[model samples]
Target: MSGTSPSVAAGAGQLPGTGRTAVVTGASSGIGAATARRLAAEGFDVVVGARRLNRLEALAASIGGRALPLDVTEPASVAAFTAALDRVDVLVNNAGGAFDAAPVAEADLDSWARTYEVNVLGTVRLTKALLPKLRASGAGDVLFVGSTAGLVSYEGGASYTAAKHGVHTLAETLRLELCGEPVRVIETAPGMVRTEEFSLNRTGSQERADAVYRGVREPLVAEDVADCIAWALTRPHHVNVDLLVVRPRAQAAQHKVHRDPPDRTAAR
Candidate 1:
């Protein structure tokens, strides 16, 4: 994908946020928050959902959308969240993370289960709950904020990779199953993104999180991935972007990445 960011309209409602409503999970920050803002700017009534009510409220206020407290891992929370939404034209499943960086032999079962619960089961629950609404839109879109890990495995990433692989499979299967329906299933897998909380949450340390992109000149930002999602959603109703794998130029693959050398090898 091109690194160029998609331009937003002049002002809010410049394009449409009425009539079409988008529900974004994990909208408190990172990719989810960026997507919620982008969709709102594109004239979609945006509902930002996350367990952090305060952050969601703040984001909602900034984007002129609604805020709903939601914990995707909890069935009751998902039900309550869906109950609050009257209609949904777009659903962005982005509430997922890596609990611990451990190899399979040293994996923590709890972490593995948590990863699956949040990444796979949670996505399934929300998708099932909103299927009717999506079908009703006549051009509904279901987008998953997957990861490069979903497409490729790495050392000490068994749990997260496995969970993300499930996400990829889920998206693919849903697209096939919903072939005739108006709903579209799209997945955007990003690599080496430097978000504020993603790495911190995964590694549980500021130092490690900082080290993730220490020498990388330009890692993919959340907005970059969000732009891809918005572009896919705005396409013709008949067109469906099945899967989009996005990574910064420095990151050629899941295992291969080129970092600047002491700020002198930046040109390389």
Candidate 2:
């Protein structure tokens, strides 16, 4: 907001990252990574955050964005991310994931707590820490990558569901709370996506992750979701499309899907 970017720096304040500053968390892979690339391509100087420095470095180098090794679960790391950025125009809080899939009867407290720590608390911590910069910048946009899981429940996904629900609540409250500010808050909730890294990161098993989507057809991809985010961000300054839920044509809800079997006989 308050920077000498030579672009919005002359007008009625520039967007946080417009030719200057943007901060994207959970940017190692998937939506976060895509958003960072999209923002950089949009001419924002993007800062990427994640626990994996190597991945972060590679992504940042490839896109010409800066990388900050951030573990959102830690207060110190969040503070550091905030300290590292000069002024942020867009804050994409996309650093979250699905954790554990055991039934309530067999759930462990550790996995449950970790889910909140990353999804809910991680977002809250980073958002609060960067509010000043967002407010300082005249036109800042904050996009949270929520899920349909936050809206609907799936079997054996109680922890992830509840945590996602918390995120949904957070986004709604922020939208109302920041009503008069120049900042815009948007929640992009998508149904099942074909991001291979999402499943692998959630389960820590590539084989298992592939098996989960082995037969699924027409799942949403990372760029598809990124396209939606880019569209929301480039909208008129007076418009705020607060909550957007996107799913593949085959997906009706979290529990609904249509799959076309691969052609085995066609190979013959």
Candidate 3:
């Protein structure tokens, strides 16, 4: 449990994450990819899974871990992914994203359904499929990469908000249901993350995505969230972090973000 740790978030420099197998879903880019790399560096035998086989393979090669083609929204794909693993010490459910930024009245049902299917049900499918392996491992960990959208609602985030809320509920219920089990269920809710795909995919344009973080100072990056995940996972087996909500200093809330003036002290 000792190594020359990379510069990550607080507590990430502690004991290395050795003698474990960590499965990271949606590891093609953003937070998922970063987490996979960080965990591998921490000493876990990492498994990067995503629908994009090429990206997955490349990431796996760079990290010296294995790659599996996985689509969490598809049961068969999840089953196949599960079959590839004989042991799962950690399952990082990070395969979810927002679809659109429309108001509830104008929200597209298809978009909403996609959001729910990927965010809530995707996590459920993987967690259920890997439960036995986790239990058998004796120090199993299930970590969900949730969002702040789950905690609060916004004007144009009805679909994503609802879906993330479901994720929150799922994590909470699973923890309660598995109270006596040896596994630990943890959730990390990040806010205002400036990933290339998240905002771009939601708006379907580079302009809109850029606007999401324009003039914002030091918005949370994928690496920041990954650091948090690694820190939580590396803790002692008895310590279980139920839910961790992280946000940048400029992001006070979903609606109360400090957008104007760029800096509060600038006006002074």
Best by lDDT: 3
Task: For model 2, give the RMSD to the true fold.
Answer: 4.5
Candidate 1 matches the true fold with a TM-score of 0.92
Q: Whole-model Cα lDDT per candidate? A: 0.87, 0.82, 0.89
lDDT of 2 at 16: 28
Worst 10 residues of 3 by lDDT: 1-10
lDDT score for candidate 1 against the true structure = 0.87
Q: Name every residue pair that clashes in candidate 2.
A: 1-137, 16-88, 16-89, 17-21, 17-89
lDDT rank order: 3, 1, 2
Count residue pairs with overlapping backbones in model 1.
Answer: 4
| Model 1 ranges off by over 4 Å | 1-18, 263-268
Query: What are the TM-scores, per candidate, against the unseen true structure?
Result: 0.92, 0.89, 0.92
Candidate ranking (TM-score, best to worst): 1, 3, 2
Q: TM-score of the candidate numbered 2? A: 0.89
> How well is each residue in 115-165 modelled by candidate 3, as lDDT tens digits?
999998988999999999999988889999988989998889999999999
